[model samples]
Target: MASEAAPGSIGGAGTALPRHVAIIMDGNGRWAKKRFLPRFAGHKAGVEAVRAVTRAARAIGIEAMTLYAFSSENWRRPEEEVSDLMGLLRIFIRSDIDELVQENVRLRVIGDYRRFAPDLVKLVDDAIARTAANSGPILVIALNYGAQAEIAAAARSLAAKVVAGEMAVEAIDDAAIERELDTHDLPPLDLLIRTSGEVRLSNFLLWQAAYAELLFVDTLWPDFDAAALHQAVTTFAQRQRRYGGL
Candidate 1:
């Protein structure tokens, strides 16, 4: 487990806790392999980790938490695995909805829902609606998501507007693209963390993470805990955050 001091204790990190944090949960298969267990077992453990981290984030006053759950590239995996992931999603929603509402967490999913099965889509939509009124942490799950694909989709929409004379070609810019994204209303990511020692973005939030602080950890997704999350936030607070300019 990772470790960091309690939240709001000033004078050490200069009150640098991030308001928003994003995570790319990685290495579930590898973790299962190491344990000589089925890959789905690792995924199950990762779900528990998600629960722990979410509660921890809320406890620390984080305003937003975005999790890269499934990427567009993940569709290439075996059909069985894909189906298992979908099952897990359903289980998560069913098991957590009441708890989430009680905890005041609003859940939002960002991705191409058109690709999901009708039953799964209905479950996701129901979860969103149920938690929409929550006033606590905003939990964003990126399932079936791809940063490149998101950008491409946004561009296609913008291009169509230009062709239809609804928008001038010259007027198209960053803000316009952002408005077209699935996460338009959310604030930019303040910290991006990846588990299982992976060092790549894996096509997650490419546009929004342009100025985010990153924390890499070797712990597998299943093993990530509140301690790990706190450490990540503490590390984020220590950074300079110069953005694009010094």
Candidate 2:
């Protein structure tokens, strides 16, 4: 694991960057409402922001970036809106797969896919398979994910092991539970950013973000750009991460 240096530690040329960064993309509906356009329009524009940010993260040397794309709670949205969002996801995958491949960016989806439509699940699987060989930074998309549910599932899995005598109940530790989570293979989360002025985690990466520095920006998801990402990263580089130590 690549641990971050203490605050104010300068690297060879510039400030050391976070190894892993996660984002909560928010305010698409509000952006569209303010512009007197349908909410779906904002979602379409948000896709462009995702592309821009992905390129920016890769350029800035971030090892991994996780995006809170669709939440498990999003199923309560209006039928038409949900349909539109799903359509946008498909379009994004199809249109951007080539670029991602060329850039050596690996696409990984971390969420429960059993509830997704078969075709949508297939598209996700295909995207992951296609990018499996990429050596560059990873782009993790959280679709239909809920942090509480994920934690409960991990706990249940461990409980089953104890019941079957496969593991001792007292042996359960932070590291043991982390291995069962969806982000097990990714780098430790270093920074978490929420756009549109939201200051809450909103059920995103609850465990992984335990020690991550949080940044809240007022920019809507549709309006977010590389410059915004750069600013957030620059701010992150200046913060001290004590992790309970002085």
Top model by TM-score, which number? 2
**lDDT, model 1, position 32:** 96
Which lDDT tens digits does candidate 2 get at residues 1-246? 112323233222378688899999999999999999999999999999998888877776788999999999999999999999999999999999999999999999888965888999999999999999999889999999999999999999999999999999899999999999999999999999999997899999999989999999999998888878877878988899999999
lDDT of each: 0.87, 0.89
Which runs of model 1 end up more than 4 angstroms from their true locations?
1-14
The 10-residue segment of model 1 with minimum total lDDT is 2-11
Cα lDDT for residue 15, model 2?
Answer: 86
Give the C-alpha miss distance for residue 60 in model 1, angstroms: 0.6
lDDT of 1 by residue, 125-206 (tens): 9889999988878999998999999999999999999999998999998899999998898978899999999799999999
Residue 172, candidate 2: alpha-carbon lDDT = 99
TM-score of each: 0.93, 0.94
Give the Cα error of residue 15 in candidate 2, in Å: 0.3
Candidate 1's TM-score: 0.93
